[model samples]
Target chain A: MRCAKRNTILLLALLLTFAAWTSAQDEAPYYQSADFNVPIIAGWQNQSANEAAQFHKPAASATIRAAMATGADAEAAAAADLASWLGLAELTAPVYRGKVNLADGTWHVLARDIDAQRSVSQVARQAGDRFIVISFLESDPSSRIVMLAIAQADETLETAEPEMDSALEQLTGLRLDNLTAAQARALPGGEWLVYQSETALVAGSLFGNDSYIALQEGTAGDLAALADAWRGTLLGFFITPDNSPYLWLGITVSLLILAALAGSFAWRARALQKDLAMIEQLEKADAR
Target chain B: MTQHEAENPLAVRPQPRLLRALTIVSALGFAGTLVLGLFVAGTDIQQGQVQRIFYIHMPSFFGAFTAFGATVLGGIIYLWRGSEAWDRIALAGVEVGLAFALINLLTGSIWARPIWNTWWTWDPRLTSAAVMCLTYAAYLMLRAGIENPQRRRSLMSVYGIFAFISVLLTLFIIRIVPDTIHPVIVGASPQNAQGAFEATSGVVVALLPSLLLWLTLMPITLMWHRYRLALRQEAVDALKLKLLGA
Candidate 1:
């Protein structure tokens, strides 16, 4: 009887371990947007919520990751989206690869690899309502093919290529590796940096237009390892947009102000000139 | 003195040669600051190239502060003595302050784009600055709307004094308030900071006098030009009134 009870306990323990393993495998980290979601696996990071955002992994080397959020008044939302598109375009322009339409019809891909830098590669695509960008940074010699997959509710990509290419040309040689966390923290205006490290930094508004999620991953020591580590910490972290909203709002308002100022100055000068001319005419008439 | 200056006290007067020479020196000083700030300052190790924005950005704040300070002084004196000269001085201060404020705000935005990953945030310092800019802008509009000279000067003097509070708040809000994420660039300790950079001794040496001279020269040149404009406008208005009588 004693042997039978021991055997029963061992079987139960085995079953519990199996359950835990399955659950871990099933858990997919994700950031959701209005149109779709970008799902990351167990080790990817969730750094989202900015009108524009930058994500970095502290353990990873220097790399630039940016996104634009959707879900605001249409004009502001468009502005936010444009900002992200411009950033990605600039980032990939120097090492532009070919553009191809995927079989899915809803997803379009642009592939790029840096000249002479075998380890650097970037993939930018439009998936559904979100523009998804993935870049690889490994200065060391490694040709590991990394994959950043996205899963979403409504996946769709359409015809916006020619305009995108023209805009991409405007992005002439922007260095992706130079920005630091400290610099991200010190910026004024209502933008925020979500995370920072020696080699990586993430900055964006936490309350941006509610864009999609991005997952980073791959083999160890490369960019994938960092993304995996970031994903591991996502559940434990609670973050906000680090910038003051007043800064964002103030940009448009200040433009209007400067315009008014110029107008006022012009009107005053013109009016004064007219008054002077009228006075001179009257003075000559009186003398006559 | 010219006949116009002798006959009408409000005539536009030519700038004195010494003042013009000083203005020339100030222009040279501005050129020197641009050279030293862009080239001579060492690259910040942490922030990289974007850190260069601080050289001009901080000086612009100082320029605005100087102009704003003059506006306050001019306001108090105009109220106490009722001199049109002080009123003109006060108006000139506002215009120059507005120009410097714009420079301070725009350079900050450019710097923030790379470092902060966003173009602007309404942080405490930035918010206070916007308020100050709007307040002065409204002051200019108020002056434009008023037809009565005495009333316009008096109202603006009072308005200038009141608007100065925003400047003070902008300068001190980051220090007194703990809510700001904006790092203190002037009195920061060795603790790590994002968007914070150290100006090397060389940078500091180049930056200080350049900042001071920039503050001093911007107002002197701009105010001198503005005052001349105001004087000529006044004369034109008086001549218009005389012509109407004729």
Candidate 2:
């Protein structure tokens, strides 16, 4: 009866464990890659592989690709990545090039016209021996939207107003004064201050002492949605830390201790054998 | 029975069928659980591959718990019945439990070096665990020092029973102190901000089997082998005395 009760308890435990293993979540909430991990864009199609994560929005004709590239520095890494990503032998210089220091590192932000139909806006930063480049490519020919990340001019400014004024004048071909009063709009990434004119609409969101500004040539595109997506991607992206060496060391230590314990048992048994043999010889000598 | 076996009932005997079977099961279960921990579980994006050590780290603690619990049981029973076999079992438990506790300490320290940014700390839980290991280690040294057989067994039995207080302290010190960065395995998140352990399904599957194997099979098999070796040592000591006396 006791043995049966023990078997029944074991069976119950196995059953409950099996239930937990089957019912629990199998997938993590984010898309994991070799070089990094990023939140899966809810409505976008995932086409991720190797050290890169790519999300495509067919409706918007926009593709966001975050990847690890190797080169001399952030600028060179961004250029080489564009060359390989778009398969172009020679490329023209970027229309806009700047740098911003964020929580992780200094990022080099660049905007370029890949061709008449293709435009690419990318940010790159050096990570360890390589560079992490995140690009926003617009394939729609009719869309003449320009996106740029600008550094904050002052530490005291509560908003990215100074950078927004610059982005508006430089990208929209108009001064900030030409637009109406700045209106604050709460968005997914953060609070943004948007300025609008008769011909163009510009929006800038403040994040980590920098301004991520978007300017659409015409007031027809959903730049707010696009900016939210960009913020989500940027905020969610991070390089997975590698602490595998410590894991290997831990395993080595455990195995060695266990082996030593096992070896001690064998050593004792062998010594007992030698002692038993000596006892038998002593008895034989006494009988003789 | 042979003359030697009849004269000394503690002579070497053939391995039991149940013990032999348990040994086989323990070996295979260890291999299977290792594969599950190392391969089946996902790498933590925050801590990366080093997080896999947790599957072993948590289970080694439970293994030590079982071995120490056995020592307590053996001591109590030996005191009640005055059986030398139970005293041998109590001693075997100490040796086995001490080895497991060392594994637990060594692995946890190595893991903490990467996660907690330090190889050692004076946290309450860790200090108590260190003291627990040292207390049991002293039991071995004290047992060796005693020359009288009955006195050694009686004194060590009492020592083993009291040393379990350290295990109790190690198990509950986190609650008493509340400042420890060491993780509480159940019902709450870890105190250390950096050493977050997310219990994903894959990690659970690996950890459950490894936990069960180490908690039950590993300690039992090792202690049984140790117990048999102690019996042989007793027989050999008697034989040496007989020869020396002549």
Candidate 3:
């Protein structure tokens, strides 16, 4: 019977493993570090190493880098990160510096033209002693592309139009009405609402009721590509909070409680032995 | 008196080979499952290391469920057959069941501290679980307070049967009450589930063994030990009474 029971347990273990394998959902590909995670952008050269998640697009002449930097503030941290990657001395003051507040935190959005070919756009926010910086660099001599994420103007009505218009006005000092609207284009990432003029091209995608839009100038047709990549990283990347202390605390308390329960049984048994000894002494006195 | 002691079901005897084996197996299995949950499982991408607490938090509740189920069964049988053995089992269930319930309740509170950003909430599921723990705890207190042996056994038996309702409520309240932040691992979670993550293969593999061990072996082994302890306690009590009369 015991052998049969053992065989049944082994069979059940096998069945459980099979069920788990079948039931498990396909986990999305993510570039994970001890501190954070970002979706691995498809068709990009993965240049990530150490503590950072970085991806490069040779076709678009762009490299997207997400990392942490030590500085006094968000803007300083962003500048520090850009300096390390794009050669700090070669860059001048940003053409555009603005701030956008999202669900996670307030982000300092800055755009810098590094010499003539390379242009860098960054979003930085302070997280504890360090700062989280995601920089989008386009080294193409022909065109400039800027990627930005902003909270939706209206929560109930989610369309990329308002944010697209705002981006055009803010980035190029032009209205949305100035640009001709193209047919809604479908991509592997999601639906893109594209707007372009003679010089500037704009494309935006909606994720979690927020607008992730890309602005490009010159002869580059990589607005759709940049928009898709930005949408993937900006919307999905999350800093996995360091909460291991709570886990350790939970484990320690559980073990302590279990040990106490076990110890109580032994304590009671010792007391029982003492009681028996007392009973024996009393019985001996009465017998005498 | 010796004949009466021989007739009593609560009489002390050498540990049965089956019970001894079960105790060893259950202890080893409990340790093994804990190791699996702590080390073998992959860290959740979303919730981080704190998510590991789910392995213990969920299974410990089920452990309480099994123990309390035994209590209800013991209660019913004791009532029907008027057997002291059944009453001893019922009493053992309350003590052992309460410990598991406490583990479930406190581990949840600790987990919530990091995830939900709060130590405690009066959500329907949380409230029901707390009330369930309290109800079983009250069983132990009331048992000690009652003077008459026959009366205490019958009263607590009825209490044990009714208290099972709290366990059921705690188990299913998240479903019955639509507005909740508590995430379900099986089906679609509620709209407002805080710190929810998908149950991937790693979660399932770690959870399955722990679930099986807590459900079957741990409670049964612990309760059987408690049953023997209760018998020894009763025997000592009877000796004290006889000595006082002499």
Index of the highest-lDDT prediction: 3
lDDT for residue B107 in candidate 2, whole number 0-100: 91
lDDT of 2 by residue, B1-246 (tens): 544556666757877898899989988998888888898776778788888999888898889899999889899999999999899889988998999899899898999997788999988878988999999999999999999999999999999999999989988887777787887766674565347666766677788889999999999999999999999889989888988898
DockQ for the candidate 1 complex? Answer: 0.05
Predictions in order: lDDT: 0.54, 0.83, 0.84
How does residue A277 of candidate 1 score in lDDT?
62
Q: Which fraction of the native contacts appears in each prediction?
A: 0.10, 0.76, 0.58
Q: Whose lDDT is higher: candidate 1's or candidate 2's?
A: 2
- TM-scores vs. true structure, each candidate: 0.51, 0.81, 0.87
Best by DockQ: 2
Q: Which candidate, 2 or 3, would have the higher lDDT against the true structure?
A: 3
Of all native A–B interface contacts, model 3 reproduces a fraction of 0.58
**lDDT at residue A130 of model 3 (Cα atoms):** 91
* CAPRI docking class of candidate 2: medium
- What is the per-residue lDDT of model 1 for residues A1-288, given as tens digits with 9 covering 90 to 100? 999999999985675465445434543243433332333333324445543233434344333333433433322333344345434332233322234333323222222333233233333444345444444343333222222222222234322222222322322221223333322222222222232233332222221111111211132343324433322222222222223343333333433544454455557656765776666566667778
- Write candidate 1's Cα lDDT for B1-246 as tens digits: 433345555553556786678768876886776666656664444445556667667787788888888888899999999988899889988997887788778777767776677878878777888888889889999999998999999999999999999889988988766566566777863233347654445566457757887588866776776666677788877876776676
Tens digits of per-residue lDDT for model 3, B30-49? 88888878887878878888
Quality of model 1 by C-alpha lDDT: 0.54
lDDT of 2: 0.83
Query: For model 2, what share of native contacts is present?
Result: 0.76
User: Candidate 2 or 3, higher TM-score?
Assistant: 3
